[model samples]
Target: MRPLKSLVAASVLLSGCNGMPVAFTQDPVYDQAFVVHSGGPLPYMLMGTAVQWNEEYAVTVKHIPYVPGSVYQGQGDIQFFRHKANGVPLWRGYTPGEAVTAVGYNSLYMSVKGSGHALPAMVRLDAKEGNVLYGTHDGPVAKGMSGGPVFAADGKVVGITVAFLSSSELAALKRPDLASQSRVSIFLPYAEINREWGRYLAQAQPVTAAPTHLASR
Candidate 1:
């Protein structure tokens, strides 16, 4: 996600003064979800742009007295949890160890076939306990599978199924050492999207109107 420099600057200006809570007289807006998908069975990660900022707040009173905006690009994986609806999330952590492929519109694809180099597999996890969910045997990813939704048992769209890993990468799996450590494909976390929801909304929101007194002065 891209960061908001304007908001960061505004926060800095507001920080200089302290007293009442400042209201963002304007409404908040956000952008559409952006994602990247992997080609095969490995997990996919989510990425987006955002604005980072520093704020000053009173220790006694839980309030933000100042805010600054600096724009930056942020990325993370889509994690799955049970308590929610669709597996899609607004924010989450980054999982670098997981191999990911780039798909259009911030979505990722992974595989599950054990024999194939990088096979795509759905990430089945216990929502309540956060345990790995698995099936009886490895499954093959079909052509039409790409872009299809990967859901938890609760029917949450945790990720989109992409492609498989290349033959060379698959070949590496033949080694007992590699097979133990690596999987054919990866699953993208849904939580990654939830984390940037605020900034995305802010970017889309209409800029607030300057106060009448300030405008006249």
Candidate 2:
């Protein structure tokens, strides 16, 4: 683990200000995933990534920071700039220190440059009972990474980015120096996500095309 940096970069949050994620691969899934937009204005700016769960709804973290009463908040919209995701639910299973990929808006307004890119990250599992399925690691998980999908070694969704360890939490673990290394943290392993969100998948309907006009015969 790396030494602690300033806490400004500490604590992973739910994801961002909003913009589309650039293409990570030619793979249809990666191509389809992009930042999703909602809400409005400076203070209300909000963004996150979502996968095409099925026809009706995409899977994303439930807690969005910019939404009112949320832990994180901001304002803007950018999903329109890129292709809306058509990704299927991710395949799951992971190990500590495993290589994983994270795709989301890293910047609040996409002003920070590299923030909107779909990048690779690693998994750092903490040895705690409650966090058994969940884990902590060097995210790179910035404000916009929430709701972004965490892909496994096989390149499938294993987790949805959720919360990260805070400076205080690190101190409690007696690893105060690791704050920097732990900065941009991640939680919400896919196993847990599937258990919770899986039920709805079956209940969902398939995406279908609109009926054609066929006006004159």
Please name the candidate that would achieve the greatest TM-score relative to the true structure.
2
Total clashes in model 1, counting residue pairs 3 or more apart in sequence or in different chains: 76
What is the C-alpha lDDT profile of model 2 across 21-139, one tens digit per residue?
34333454444345654544434365666555444445555444333222211111101112233445656666766666665556543411112112234333333223334454454
Stretches of model 2 off by over 4 angstroms after superposition: 1-29, 38-44, 65-89, 108-133, 173-184, 198-217
Candidates in order: C-alpha RMSD to true structure: 21.1, 12.4
TM-score of each: 0.28, 0.53
In terms of lDDT, the best-performing candidate is 2
Give residue 43's lDDT in candidate 1 (0 to 100).
32
Model 2: how far is 133 from its true place, Å?
A: 4.9
Q: After superposition, how far is residue 182 of candidate 2 from its true place, in Å?
A: 4.5
Q: List the residue pairs that clash in candidate 2.
A: 4-180, 15-146, 32-85, 45-74, 45-75, 45-76, 65-72, 90-157, 158-190
Error at 217, model 1, angstroms: 19
